[model samples]
Target chain A: MHADSTTTRKAAALAAFAGLDREPGVAKPDPILVVDNVVRRFGGLTAVDVAHLEIQRGSITALIGPNGAGKTTFFNQLTGFDSADEGSWAFNGKQLKGVPAHRVARTGMVRTFQLTKALSKLTVMENMRLGAQNQRGENFFRALVPGSWRQQEDEITERAEELLERFKLNTKRDDFAGSLSGGQRKLLEMARALMVGPELVMLDEPMAGVNPALTQSLLAHVKDLREEGMTVLFVEHDMDMVRDISDWVVVMAQGAVIAEGPPDTIMSDQRVVDAYLGAHHDAPMSAEEFEEQLQEAEAELEAEIEEKA
Target chain B: MDWNAILITTVKASIGLETVVYALAAIGVNIQFGYAGLLNFGQAAFLGVAAYGMAVTVATFHLPFWLGIAIGLAATVVLAFLLGIPTLRLRADYLAIVTIAAAEIVRLVFRSVKFSSVFGGSDGRQNFSGDFFAMNPYSPGTYGIGPISFNERVTWILTVGWVLIAICCGLVYLLMKSPWGRVLKAIREDEDAVRSLGKNVFSYKMQALVLGGLVGCLGGFLFALGQASVQPDLFSTEFTFYAYTIVILGGAARVFSPVVGAAIFWVLLVFVGNTLSEAVSAGMLPSLFTVNNIGAVRFMLVGLGLMLLLIFRPQGIFGDKREIALDAR
Candidate 1:
């Protein structure tokens, strides 16, 4: 029964993109974030130069690329962490091009870092409390008068407790964030991001250093975010995660989008294969195959030397 | 050797005016550097500006004493803003550099002959604290136990200084427990992490700077009132360094640690200096340590003691061991 229900939900999640063409920068039925002519240059090298792209609302979109593909840079620009040389993008139909990172987050879109930035000195609970928005006691004058914000403070703590429980970090609530293991910190960061009550959540490599044992739980959490009706945009190199949780996939190479489609189709796309594996190679070279080829080349050189002698 | 006098002097110096001044300054440093992780090497500038503000208002302009107090606090806030606006948004090192330079600049400006009429140049200003003494409610008598006592004027100033320190400590305790202070602490750890969570990191830093500067200004007010004079040379870089030393020695991030740190620091200096001078005069030490050079040698011994403290217990007297481990991250 669970399997059948999950398939139905997955189908419903992908129904929005059913009629869209499998092409780079295809228009979505409902775009929550729209980008146009976003370009970033570093000296003589053009880092990110995406012409146009749209993120479908309430769908899990995976941004995948090889090393130095500018996937992280593009995420920075969209989330206001880094400024683009020239670009225009809108979140929820509001112009967010020049907005600062904190203001952008205030507008219901929050991001996590590529290198997880868990505030080490803060306790897990304090880190969670810092994530909450519109805190009354966060104001300097209001903080001095506890009577004014006592109720709000209690409510925020209650919410933080709920998130901590959900993320399975309740046991480590009072421990410093720095004390958490790599996997636990990832879960805490995701749970903390949810404390903002964001509509669109952006995660940069949520599973970068996480162990495989914890990868299953992390994947479930990502899926749960979509179930709760929040859009998720993530930059990742893990294709298994993208295929399992992502509803749609956008592939970038050389700082530009190369392909866009459902996960299965995008995996089979020839352009993606060319981008990952060079055009001349029909299939990816495995380590064993590479080793065999190296041995063969060395043997051939020895035979040539023997013939010459 | 007059051992009784030396012991009494040590006890007195522990809670003396110098202790109150450094304690207040260190409390301010605790807020900015300890809690917020701001590198404000120019904290002396905040105190300098406050002293000069009051001196210029009351002695030079003939304003009311209360107005001078208000102006002193206002000048501290303005100085915090001026330093914070350009550097708080940058990395932590920038504030350290700017603050150290700004403090020297403030001292130089006050020492300049061009503003001698207004700021009194090297002599600074005097007779500005007459109104402050006139308001004291203490009668003309010594007040204390045994040998450690104060006159009416000193008793009043000490009472005010201790009260101000209590209020500042209370304020720090309340703020650090709130979400506002949590944001500052988080910013101290990683500003980008706090920024990503929707906090205006720059504003919080600026507020921490201003709050700390105001606390530092209280120290300046007490110093000026206690001496009835403000000297430009007294508010030098070493004054700020002494405050930093006290903060680190007491324990960073704890509300009352600076107070404890200040008392210990003063007692050590006074005790060591007195002992050294007495030994030199009594012929208890070698001729290499004459009375004239004992002052300098006393400092060297104290420096060695501080170095030992840092090596053995870097977290200070009251700091959490867990915090020191987290700082390694």
Candidate 2:
């Protein structure tokens, strides 16, 4: 069909993101999210063109790619912020096309943004309240009756407070969210996502700008998400963090997945190396290099805390 | 100034006609912008819609006053939904724009020559408030504890208005403390994160919009019944702007913030206005301005106060800077 370089690139991306060599028999019994042929065009640029992708039920899958590789766009499309020009997906068995972002969230698939949109003016606890907002008591009639709204309000606050505590944000409950550091915000974002008790949680760059010392804890939290029986799909640039925590890895280059497999195999793949290291494929930080950085951060943090005491 | 004069001024300013109505409207704005963070700029439309609803039902259809109120509340919710459905997911500013436009549309609709019979056009409907006064328990005689007495009719309106304010504020306080309130705060902080938790962000936003609009509708009711009239000129964009000013002045997102804000807003404006006019008449200052400048000067002073508040305490009196720190856009 004499497709241009962009289409070829998209076609290539689609092939790679679709998990190139998957045989039909190997697929899971039921997929939580099944994204097929989801192509998104922004102006003249085709940002994402995935032929097929399946998020397994109750497992952590890290959607890893370089910047501008359409990871966030893909996440937005799935969650209803952005609509797909072509393609369809579903949460559990429900087809998700034309579903509004809010409705997508209602179906038990929630997400966090790359840029933290925490209500800066509200207390940290108030932010938690927003996460637990449901429709039952939000009705006009219910709002008119104090007795009707109290129990639900109490339960939501308690749960939100508990989640904040679990995330180590309990002490800052009264503090404004804007007062928190970048890392704390990331933590708050993650904690807030647990509000609606979603079956699927999508995190956009959960560890992108976090300090190394907290990276492990963040990674642990992502792993804990799976432990808690919620499927976690996260977009990450830190390969070591992805490799260390993710059960399955999906790698994208130029808006499509180029490789999908166990971390060890994906890391060793020739194409994956070329994508990260460029055609010359040399002089990139190794896994050992990453481990050393995290270790150093951990040591320094411990020393500081010890000194404070 | 005499103690009696100040007391009268304070009472007139606090429980004054415009004060009670705007207080109800400002509380609604708090629900929309302060609580839900919807950034609604067309709250006046809710007031306008409800007023027109009442005016049409009463003056046009000759229906009972309560039925008109129901239609008005319904119309506000419908207006909110119509505005929210198209623009809620768009940038928050889009909702602001659409609402402002819708409110203007509503005002024009009420004032349009084509619908003059039903809406009473520009001059609006009057003597329509007789039904509202029929429900008043107060006799048609003045009553008071002392110098703070009110005309029988004025007392009746204020009584109803204050009760509505208390109920709305109390309801807001309880509702805001609930699970739904938590979700709204979360949406304000991070809609994406809330959505990740399987929450319906859009639906919640719509609910907030409608709820806030429903509350705003009460302002229209109070205004219509307070003056015993409904005028197209009354529901101007400035009405909503003033409500926002009240919300910000008292505090955004706090239960008592709007009520306190409404009282302060009306008082400062009236007190300053009266003081300025008296000063100009007495020639206390050089004749740089005439009595006509009092209105402009009062507005300028109020605008200056809002500016100072935004600069020094953008969160208003009760708002936390952090809660307001979320990208307002």
Candidate 3:
């Protein structure tokens, strides 16, 4: 029963990309975000320079790369947090170039910070309520008259409460977010983003500082997002998480997309391997074999030294 | 020591004009610094600009008193926008730096000889408050209980000032409890976090600046009317620092804290200055401690008291310790 249920869960997302080739910038069957000629430069260094990329709708896409791969910078450009030097991207058929960060989020694409911004001074519940868009009470004039926004506030509180319960943070609802543990903060941040009712959720290194015991639950939360039909794009360095949760993987190296494929295939892709471990690293060898190779090189060096003498 | 005279003056100072003006100014600081985490070091500039706006319009252009009032408010809002547009997008400290400089510039411009004919240079404008006093509903008689009392003109301004303070406190309370206030507090903690959640952080900061500036401008209007004159030096950087001191003393971000804090601050200064001068006159202290230097001594003693209060309760009189803990960022 467990195996059958797991397969059914995977079937929904995997089936969509079954016929697509494992190639860089291959067209998705139903792309939600399409980027073209995106470039960002700081001084003389180009931080992110992607020619083309497409995010499939309703799939968990893992953007995997080593440090300084410009994954976060690309995320920043896509979400309107940072402007690209030259690029235009469309989200759900709307041109998002030059759009402000808040409007981009209002357009159903919400992002979380890598550092986990939990609004430390606010209670967990207030932090959640802050994520609800188009709040009537948020308007300055309407805010003064409690009658105008009381009902909407109640509804927002109700929704926030439900999300808190689902995230198992109902008990900490009234507690300041600053009091939460690192793992709980990540959960709260994810739960708060859902209050926006976003179509696309971008998480930047959600597991970076999280503890191991909470990793399983965090993984479950990511899967639940897919189950609810929301597209998720996450940046991660943990190979286990990338392989376990991601349906599609995009590898970035030196400010460019080097490989794209399903997680299983991308793990063995030659270029992906080279990007991670360098081109010189071949198949793994036994310890004795490695030692033997080192000694052989040392013996050849000794012979050269003797001939020179 | 003239105990009765000292007691009367000290008690009067607790509810004096200075207290009301600083209370209102500190309330504005509470909104900007206490809630929004905006470092508005130029709060005195808001007061200065409003006073000058009204003074220039009425004294120079011979406009109606009401028009001068309107112009003052309009100028304050414009000043807020001007100061906010460039600095709100930068770090919080930039606003502090710009506001401090802008405040000095406003004072100097009012004090400048180039516009002496318009701004009255060092003399400032007078006779512009005739309409304000004429509108007083109270009859010409002393009104008060015991030592805390005022004549009809003083009573009228006091009534108006206290009513303004009550209204501002009500407005702040209502706004702070709403979703808009929640966003401001969230911005205070982490603006980038609020922005990522779909809030227009810049717009919110600007609105906060304007709202706080308007409230602070009320103090400026009161100062002008009470003195029946607008002086540039009265709205100097020292005025802004006093307002900040009152806000911190009263426990920032709390409604009514500024009012209470301002009362306490003036009371301490008046009480200390009166006692020290009285003592010096009576030859109770040494010859070096003269009445002339008692004003400076009062501040020195009060500064020590403030240092002690901060050490024991850094969060101020009513601030939450948990909030202070979260201020590590």
Superposed on all Cα atoms, the candidates' RMSDs to the truth, in angstroms, are 6.0, 12.9, 5.0
Candidate 3, position A101, lDDT: 91
What is model 1's DockQ versus the real complex? 0.71
Better of 1 and 2 by TM-score: 1
- Residue A287, candidate 1: how far off, in angstroms? 29
**For model 2, what is the alpha-carbon lDDT of residue B161?**
83
Candidate 3 wrong stretches, greater than 4 Å: A1-9, A282-309
Per-candidate TM equals 0.94, 0.82, 0.94
Residue range with the least summed lDDT across 10 consecutive positions in model 1 chain A: A1-10
lDDT of each: 0.92, 0.79, 0.92
Model 3 over residues A134-225: C-alpha lDDT tens digits? 99998999999999999999999999999999899999999999999999999999999999999999999999999999999999999888
Alpha-carbon deviation at B133 in model 3, angstroms: 0.8
Error of 2 at B210 (Å): 2.5
Q: Candidate 1 vs candidate 3: which has greater DockQ?
A: 3
The digit string of per-residue lDDT tens for model 3 on B222-303 reads 9999999998899899999999999898898898889999999999899888999989989999988987888899999999
Model 1 whole-model lDDT (C-alpha atoms)? 0.92
On the 0 to 100 scale, the lDDT of residue A189 in model 3 is: 96
- lDDT per residue as tens, model 1, A30-86: 999999889999999999999889999888999998889999999998888889899
Report interface Cα RMSD per prediction: 0.7, 3.6, 0.8
Interface RMSD of 2: 3.6
Candidates ranked by lDDT, best first? 3, 1, 2
Q: Count the backbone clashes (under 3 Å) in each candidate.
A: 0, 26, 0
